[model samples]
Target: MSTAWQDLTGRARLRDAAIEAFAAQGFEESLRSIAARAQVTAGLVRHHFGSKDALRAECDATVLERYRQLKEESLQADPHQLFTHLPASAQGGVLLLYILRSAREGSAAGRKFTEQLIDEALILLNQSVSRGLIVPSRDEPARARLLILQSLGALVLHFALNPPQDPEDFAAVMQDYYSRVALPTLEIYSEGLFTDSAYLNEYLLATAADVPPATDAGITESR
Candidate 1:
């Protein structure tokens, strides 16, 4: 532990330790082990967090809030800085491991965490759109939700099969993951998937929807 680590209150110490323990070992990791990691007693863990499940919930909230802070800072400074800064953050690997485990575990808390991620992503995506950094969507909320789900779902699958041997290796693994996917992802985002508007036109006609057909750029409304 560093000087800063030594200065934390017992509850903060226990929570930080629990986040590391759960990220490394999974939620089944015991309170005694977490206390040992924190260099605090098991009784102190109970005093602070009440139960293992409660502590896990705290970890979930903390990780999400920290991620939100990082993203907001990156966006406010420069959106492009996210790629350069996020992987280098002190808690980067641990945070990634914690979120990956939470999402893969499929518990009620995990599901809620994913939904909360989508909500945050929606807010941030809209902010980017307003800043002219991202394209506006016809249905903004749905677009944000879909993009969040797609990206996270792909990450979950990729890391589940090819997880880092240790939590500290997460940044490297993420770099490799992004290196492999970046070209294809950027291509699709920039060039688009469809060759033309034939599919959209056909679908609109077939469905006879109130919404007008899409043009070369995107969906357009009837004047």
Candidate 2:
């Protein structure tokens, strides 16, 4: 498919092309092919971005930032509603492309992008906790990473096992999959793991005679 490469500035076109190529293939995909897709010389791509790694890093920011924006927008009331609330257009293709590609390469760009993805999910989880939907936990960061991995692993695996077909059908299938399966599976997560009666209550009961009960139901961090 031919794109109007000139419609974008040289740098923009290169970034766009890199995102396309990385999304279609992987980061290990040839820079020459990306330049050709952008209608520029391979050296021009290097001139614009220094190297293929840098180019893929730029693409990672481009696509994942948009993915984050879509996530933020869809998070209307409940953060747990993330996937189910996403529009069909924002459903799983490009983000998974970049993620899968980056994980395989294990390069600087890959690690940075992966960290960024985790950080973004952590932010959303914090939002949910702040909204009082999820209780805060001492292990918020680790739990956030687990949540991100759960969603991402499912998406990455879905793409691997069942490649994209008709766009409408794919969206419907994904939406159904999330509502019927993923949402329920992750439903307990939004409650925060510490909510279980296993420890917090017992701790409170044990300490009841020693100190006044802490008003905040969330776990406190040990200094």
Candidate 3:
């Protein structure tokens, strides 16, 4: 392959490594550690990404890509298939952990990434409403924002009390909570027209099945 191709491959590898490291260990881990995992030098990491902050931004992008893929796959499968397939811990654990760590440390990148994630989620929720999956009231955006905030708060509380559990265990708890709390809350708030357990389950399944299209020009452009 040409030098450019090799460079691109290396950069991609570095980015993936950064994602895994950040997801697993947060920003506390050094760039050198990330580079070692990717089998590249720290200098190369800097050369390609320019700075740690920039590399972190790339990591956020990678995580978002994975999120989109998981959501698509879930959606395409039988309703709520992802909840059955992915442990609740793994589904939202990394992002939750990252958020908690960032907030505790007062990291700007973490805050920014979290905001971006929320924005993306809101967009998807609106899209789901348009598709007749969720029925948000006139104040759909506000309601959606509250739901996201509550869910994140729950995650932080859970993680604070215990070490991260296995994904399956997390998934089981999430399934139960969604069935008991989230679904019911949505129904009550939306006057039984916005979302129900069945609909939410179906939506979660679809999102898990979703495999974010390769040509996400529109998604990128929206940002």
Candidate 4:
């Protein structure tokens, strides 16, 4: 939040600050504390939101908007007859990190949130297959579970284990890791897993010419 943030209404400013501070520090942080972070007074915090609970609602809405944008961009129906394809580089920002932390704590609200996400995943996957947006699978429920495991699980691991503290540094790392590691791994899974595939063999054959020739001297050294 910088120059453009100056244009926001006081309420918007408070909501943005609440989302950031609460995500990093949890919802128990005081209104005064969030006000300080927002560079506003405690009076304004109450004036804008009336209560902490209302503030939390606004913060949640802010984050959910981010989630909505991601879903809209990622949910492709048909692309050149390739039913399954990777989205254009997935990302999760501060709001996602907060949600992960909350869910892992296993509070009633967190549990509910997790259940909703799982149900949504199941519904979306089942619909996609039923509508012929994706290839039919014998065990679609299992596939959906696997997808949630790989995608969301990787995110939880990254934020829970080790990620850069600085936002810019964190983004740079995500850019590289998602491009080089995460998405490719997903591609391999999307193409294989339940399907009959010779992908590995074909890949090896294509790249075999690049393999270095084994030398007798190296073999003798190994002995």
Note the Cα lDDT for every prediction shown: 0.76, 0.67, 0.64, 0.61
Q: Write the per-residue lDDT of candidate 2 for residues 1-223, one digit (tens) a residue.
A: 3345743478898897777677666666798999998888999898778987677667877877887776667656365565435534334545555666676566777677778889988888799789775677655688778877776677667666766554324345445445545555666554545544667567757877754434443655322
Model 2 has an lDDT value of: 0.67
Clashing pairs in 4: none
| Residue pairs with backbone overlap in model 1 | none
lDDT of 4 by residue, 170-191 (tens): 2444453455565567577567
Q: Which of the numbered candidates is closest to the native, going by highest lDDT? A: 1
The digit string of per-residue lDDT tens for model 3 on 120-166 reads 67777777767666653434466567766676676566556754444
Which residue window of length 10 is worst by lDDT in model 2?
83-92
TM-scores for all candidates?
A: 0.79, 0.66, 0.67, 0.60
TM-score of 2: 0.66
Off by over 4 Å in 1: 1-8, 79-82, 168-170, 207-223
Q: Largest TM-score belongs to which candidate? A: 1
lDDT of 1 by residue, 112-150 (tens): 988888888888887887787777665667877788778
- Order of models, best TM-score first: 1, 3, 2, 4
TM-score, prediction 4: 0.60
TM-score of 1: 0.79
Candidate 1 structure lDDT:
0.76
**Candidate 4, which segments miss by more than 4 Å at Cα?**
1-8, 76-91, 122-133, 136-146, 167-181, 194-223
